[model samples]
Target chain A: MTSAAQLTQAQDRFIAVWGQMAGAWGVSRTMAEVHALLYITGEPLCTDDVMERLQISRGNASMSLRALLDWAIIERAHKRGDRKEYFHAEQDVWTLFRAIVRQRITREVDPLLASLYEIRDMTAIDRKRARSDNEDLRERIDIHNQRLESMLEFFQTLEQLAAMFISPAGKGLQAAATLLSKSPREEAAP
Target chain B: MTSAAQLTQAQDRFIAVWGQMAGAWGVSRTMAEVHALLYITGEPLCTDDVMERLQISRGNASMSLRALLDWAIIERAHKRGDRKEYFHAEQDVWTLFRAIVRQRITREVDPLLASLYEIRDMTAIDRKRARSDNEDLRERIDIHNQRLESMLEFFQTLEQLAAMFISPAGKGLQAAATLLSKSPREEAAP
Candidate 1:
């Protein structure tokens, strides 16, 4: 039988790896560690439990839990006849990924897209003004405007693609896999 | 014509926004700012230019530039009869994204997949050891192993999809858009 020590070791390793993965993706290590603990335990754990298991401070545990809650990847749970609030992670990896992706699109991509549109509009107006001033400056603005337009198109397309992937009937990953399995190279050979 | 002051203001705003976006994605603000500067200028810039324009220390600029170069989104260039090394961004947004994605897949996803596989194997061995000694321990290990397998499958599928998208003739973005536009719901309806 696997000893209790072995079990603890395995859990610790998993949490550490998960924490590193989250760090690479721009998430706080503590937040990722908290989620990893909950996920590996497959049970609701209180902040005290998290603190004990991860060797983190009370405030750190509390903040990590709150951040996870904000990300919608973890939830507060009430144990039967227990006063301490516990937490559990959304076990489905795909759903968790979708939530993160959705949040990033709204928080980061949307703002960038809006800014790009504004910049493009402003540059276009400036381009018009520069046309009759100096040929060199006008040409420079023209190139810049073209690049901005291309960049805007790229982001717009990317946003549309992300939305489609996250749609209910998307099955995007599955569909892409199927398409890839069909061998595009042979079709393109002609 | 738009005055130089206005142009500088717009560039500064764009760089600031770009830095924030990069931070969300786990890149340093300075690295993103440097790339943004080069991207906007559409021209190569030396270390001094980047330092002066961004108001960053020489060491900070050098480090950020080196990091960007490592990511392959920027390249070092030399001016004729000049010893100073200038850097330029990829300029093409699609190409820039491809470079970033490629680097991430190599540096992050590949290592993660390897570790998950190792963890799964270790858990499986432990599950076997527990089966004859303790039923409860075995069951718990089994559940953990199952979760690990599911997680592994999820990552494998993601890696496969990433590979296909990055393959030659993939036209990944356009292809995804086309697939999404076809209305999978209607196709699935009886």
Candidate 2:
């Protein structure tokens, strides 16, 4: 096959893999495919380019591009004297990863933490109202409180870790990468 | 409301929140609800208990329980003179998190990494076979290779981090927690 054909084949495989794996990561397949197309080609692509290449509906391509913009992984690029608005993906992998994490945290983690806190506070009011003579009820409340606290603590830690990774200073991701790359013994050594 | 009634309400809310959040984390709603029910109640429950509490069909309950067991977050329990099998969730939050990461890595990350490797290998063969006179094709292939390598490196780093977190020596998780909890300045001090 020609080199151009080989290149197209590789790009197709990359897009296919990305689309397939997206569901496992809680992302839409089409959205990932759109992003993969932009990233793999390393070129500014308009809605027409996206629709034509992916064979997706115009509305679907537009929505995916809009969502990718909201996620901050892709941005609008302009060409002089051109009427069409083109989109470009953040080519730096670290930036892309951080942007995705930041988006997920905002969309998913924040609401989860809020719900956990709401539950805890709601239950706290109930815990205080229990009759003193009801030992069984009190014990059950304690257990419930403990379970909620455990979950809250775990999620809170995760939130902190995410914040560190995506902080503006940006040393956290590199530090974490270095630390995690070390063996157990190496990491453990003082 | 009575303390028992309040407890039930709390459990119900917890289950709902977990079920809703499960989709964001790529888990089934019913499966998360089943796990939440077992976990919040802190009791070894039979299939009957799960079915009645979740108001799900027997098949759904059985499937969710089986999946929870497969994820290693829940396990079978036996009671004296009881013919029915009971299931229990891992109560410790850290253990639960580790188990989940391990399961996701096996199911999602492992396959993703394999696909990436396959793509890289396949493209490498194509690159070698490309005609030397075609500079444009060579450059395109080079760009494709670079993109794949960057992604591979980032994911490989993530895999190592996950491995550290789930390693049996058990220091990795705690150490990472401590490291992440530190301010950037404090972490950089040593």
Candidate 3:
């Protein structure tokens, strides 16, 4: 097969894989496909270009582009003489992953962490009340508190790790990855 | 409110939050609720126990329990003189996370990696043919290869990190977490 045809096939395959991943991750498949097109082509694409290339509706292309922009994974661009706006993906892999991590932490993790803290505090009041009179209730509350604390600690650790990873000046992710890949005690001694 | 009432409310809230997390992570909410119930209670519970506590249908409870077992996050138990099978979650935080990471790697990451390798190999042949004839097409193929390579590398790094974390004898995750929590240069110097 011709190189052009082969390249097209490979691009389509990559887009399909990315779209599947988006579906699994609960994002719009069309939106992921649109991003894939822009990223793979490594060029600015207008909404019409997206629509024609992906065979998606104009509205779908526009909406996908808008959402991608909101995620900060894609940006608006303009050619010197062109009136139509164009979009391009943030092609750097680390930046793209960091953007996704930041967005998810904001959208999902932050609120969950808040709720966890609130629940623990609310339950702490009950524990205090139980402490005065009810031994059985106090024990149960203690167990519950322990469970909640462990979960809270795990999530907090994850949040801290994510923060380190996405920090602009930090190479924490690579450093941590390298550290983890080594034998724990052996690496420590060196 | 009474301590019992407050404790129940807290448990319910915990389960609800876990259920919401499940929905976002593309898992069944009921399944996560069942797991949460077992996990928070820190006890082996039968299907009837799960159903009554979660107010879910027996079928839903049973199905969720089975899936949890399949994921190896929960295991079956039997009480002497009691015929009913009970389920309990892996209570240790690290073990629980390791089980989930292992399951996801098998079901999601492994398949995706296989596809990536196949795509790369298929395009390598086209790249070789393009080398002789088409400069423009060859350049495009090279760009595509580079993109594919970066994605593959990122995923591979993640897989390696996960493997290290889940290794039974490895303190890799905690060690790495501690290492990352410290400034990289300071940690290295020490």
Candidate 4:
């Protein structure tokens, strides 16, 4: 039988690694650590369990769990005959990825796209109302507009691509893997 | 003709927006602001220019510029008979996107893939060396290994997709756009 110490070491390493990775991807370290703990145990953990295990304060544990719930990557659970609430992470890796991607697209991409469109329209209106005599100013504004349009186009394309991947009819993760596998071989030929 | 006041207002707004967007994508606010300034102006800017325009300290400006240079999204330039160093952001949108993607893949994804692989191997060795009678421990280790493998596979697929886009024959950004445009229609027909 493996000793308890060995298991603890492994779990600690996993949680540390996961927290670092998730932090880079915009999730806070505490939240990621809490999720990692739940993920490794594959069982519902009470707030106390999380706090004690991670050596974090009660407030930190509660806030972290709440943030994970906000991401929709964790859910509250209740055991039979238990009064305290517990939490469990979404176990499916693909589902977790989708949730994060969907959240980011909604929170970040959509608004940026709208703002770019507004900026472009406003610039166009300003250009039209201005006097036509200032060729130099007009030329500079045109270059700026062109750059903005190119950036807008790039973001639009990225958003559409993300939409396709997340849609029901889409093959989702497998589709990306398949494309990757096929394209390299095809491109290798003259 | 556009007044100096109008142009400054517009430039300020663009820098603010770009900085916000870039910060969300993992770049520092100062770095993004510096890049945005160079981008909108479409010219090389010295450290003094960036510091004065952004109202930031010299140290902050220098550090942000260094970070951008490390990402290779901006480059140093010099004018004839001038000793001061000036910097310019990559003007081509596609090239800029490619550089950011490539840098992230190297900095974040590649290291992550390596670490996952290492963890998986270590877990396997540990599981094998442990006493054979502990079925529960063995099962937990197996589950952990499975999770690691799944994550590794996902990252590997992503790396391949990135490679295809960066390849000369890949059509890179346009391929993603084309795929997005076609996939929805194809999926809808079913």
Candidate 5:
């Protein structure tokens, strides 16, 4: 376990780094730092643990955790002999990647498709520029739909692959890497 | 050019879908929609174009455009015919993927690692729980670091392969799929 002094200094460094990171990934600073805090803890931590250590509000901790849960990056800790329920990060790298893809698709792709559809129907005969812009939007709608279709197929295959392993335990990434390295042109062998 | 009817429907669909996708990717709804809008437009669009279409403020458009810029998904498109400085997405899919990976690394991995270091160094015995938890944090950190390293390397290789035309534009994915199918195990070719 990290000593308090060590922990604090480490946290300061972490927050600085995580803040920079959040901007690119499209997450808020506080949220990324909160997740960073949980990720570095050597053990599964509860809301109280996070709140006290990070000096955040009870509500803040709750909100961040729920958000993390939504991302599938952090898992509710399955601790032995503990009911308060701790939290841990997705330790397995491959699983983590899969989780991210699945969550991203659900949140970004599906919804964008819906919006594209809406923009296509808004019954406004504006100016030439406006009409042209609308055409562009429709193009995006088509491109994203096609892109997402492949992504969905990939995600579906991943889910099935994940289920295939007898033990849900993390496989060293080599197996998955090998799979990823394979040429895409080949379909599954019968 | 899209007619008023097509534009309205497209906008509605995009707006409806934007939220879920934004939530999933950790980006704001407005941000993703803005990107989607830029993406579909075959021509460079200025702030006004985005603002009027999305019914958002100039400030919002600026902020989000800056974000898209940082992510490298969209660029300032300067057309010789016009000085308004329109924006356009990087049509090259591989380039888009590379930019996203690079941005994510800077935004997430680098900063989170810094936080982990600081948190590791905090001194004082806050509690036995903190100590126990710290150890677990270390393991997770090590595992994550290794995984990220490998993943980054893989991305780097993908970029290289993409550049080398080992996988040609458009056909790169097909070539890769073919490569994967050729072997049950991805041993480096002799």
Candidate 6:
């Protein structure tokens, strides 16, 4: 059992650190802190552990964990002696990053693709003429949407490959340049 | 300068996509769409375009622009012909991503270092005793902080080099793994 003082101190420290992190990355403070808690728990923890450690509600824990699961950061784990389901972070940050990249592609890029197809298939010329204004709008969207989707698909695959550390070396990084997201130059600089 | 129809289309398309995009990523709908607009606009735009296209308030446009500027996705532009400081995206999406990654490293990772140092310098016996729970917590935080800092520093440099795309394909991505972010997967995944 940890002291109330010590636990609160740790929670405060995490909350402070995570606030800056949340704003920077677009994640919320509570979400980042909750993720940070599970990330550092050092073992798979149940809903109770999350609630106790972070002092959040069970419903909130479920929501945030589901969110993280969507990000693919935390995954399910069942300890040897325990029946309750637990969750832990993928410690290899790259692997964790890969899961997120992949999930984001599926959730973000795929839906964009669906939206593009739907708009592109709009064939009523009378409607198009009547809404040429809207048609013009849709056309530009189709153009840019295709571009982003093409780029994002490539990026997601490379991230998966990178997590595997496969196809090796500069190939993964070069993937960044020709079709990948982010610059190879930036990767090399730091 | 774009036509009213063209701008409307661009604005509508982006606003719709941004909402979906924001949900997948941690960013807000307005923030994502704002970035999207900046990405495709051939020339720099001012707050007016942002408001006109999205039908947002002047204050809302200003606030969102400030947020994007903070995120490093959008920048204030000063063209030779124009006195009004227009805003523009970095254009290269990958380059933009690199800048965001770097900024996040500075905001999120750098501050943690300061906190750990302060925790280390804690003078209270309660704070200093290694066996004490507080000290144990502090020490754990320190180690995590160090690992994160080192990782962020390494990746930040790697991203810089990768951004340049200077490394020739023959030896580039191959060289990036050791020279870039080192994934801990020692054994090649079979």
Which candidate leads the pack in lDDT? 2
lDDT of 1 by residue, B136-175 (tens): 7777776677777777877777776677666664476556
Q: Candidate 3: lDDT of B117?
A: 90
Q: Which ten residues in a row have the lowest lDDT in candidate 4 chain B?
A: B1-10
Model 4 per-residue lDDT tens digits across residues B72-115: 98999999999999999999877787788788888778987877
lDDT, candidate 2, A41-78, per-residue tens: 88899999999999999999999999999899999999
Of the two candidates 1 and 4, the one with more favorable TM-score, higher being better, is: 4
lDDT of 3: 0.84
Q: Model 1, A105-132: lDDT tens per residue?
A: 8887899999987776666567556646
Where does model 2 exceed 4 Å of error?
A175-190, B128-133, B175-190
Best DockQ among the predictions, by candidate number: 2
Give lDDT: candidate 2, residue A75. 99
Q: For model 2, how does the per-residue alpha-carbon lDDT over B17-62 read when each residue is reduced to its tens digit? A: 9999888766799999999998988889999999999999999999
Q: How accurately is candidate 5 docked according to DockQ?
A: 0.22
Candidate 2 colliding pairs, count: 0
Q: Which stretches of candidate 5 lie over 4 Å from their true place?
A: A1-4, A7-39, A44-47, A59-97, A110-190, B1-3, B15-31, B57-71, B75-83, B110-190
User: Each prediction's DockQ?
Assistant: 0.45, 0.62, 0.55, 0.44, 0.22, 0.14
Residues A99-189 of candidate 6 have per-residue lDDT tens digits of 6545555655667756644433432122234355566555655545554544444354335445444334534644443344444335566
Chain A TM-score per model, please list them: 0.87, 0.90, 0.87, 0.87, 0.56, 0.55
RMSD of each: 3.7, 2.7, 3.3, 3.0, 9.3, 8.8
Candidate ranking under DockQ, highest first, comes to: 2, 3, 1, 4, 5, 6
Candidate 5 lDDT, tens digit per residue, B87-166? 88776544555565565555555555454444443322233334454775444445444533444444443344333332
Taken over the whole model, the C-alpha lDDT of each candidate is: 0.79, 0.87, 0.84, 0.79, 0.59, 0.59
Grade the docking of candidate 5: incorrect
On a 0 to 1 TM-score scale, where does candidate 3 land against the true structure?
0.90
Q: For candidate 3, lDDT tens digit of each residue in B118-165? A: 879868877778766568888888888888888887788778777877
Q: List residue ranges in candidate 1 displaced over 4 A.
A: A131-133, A172-190, B131-133, B172-190
Model 4 earns a TM-score of: 0.89
List of clashing residue pairs for candidate 1:
none
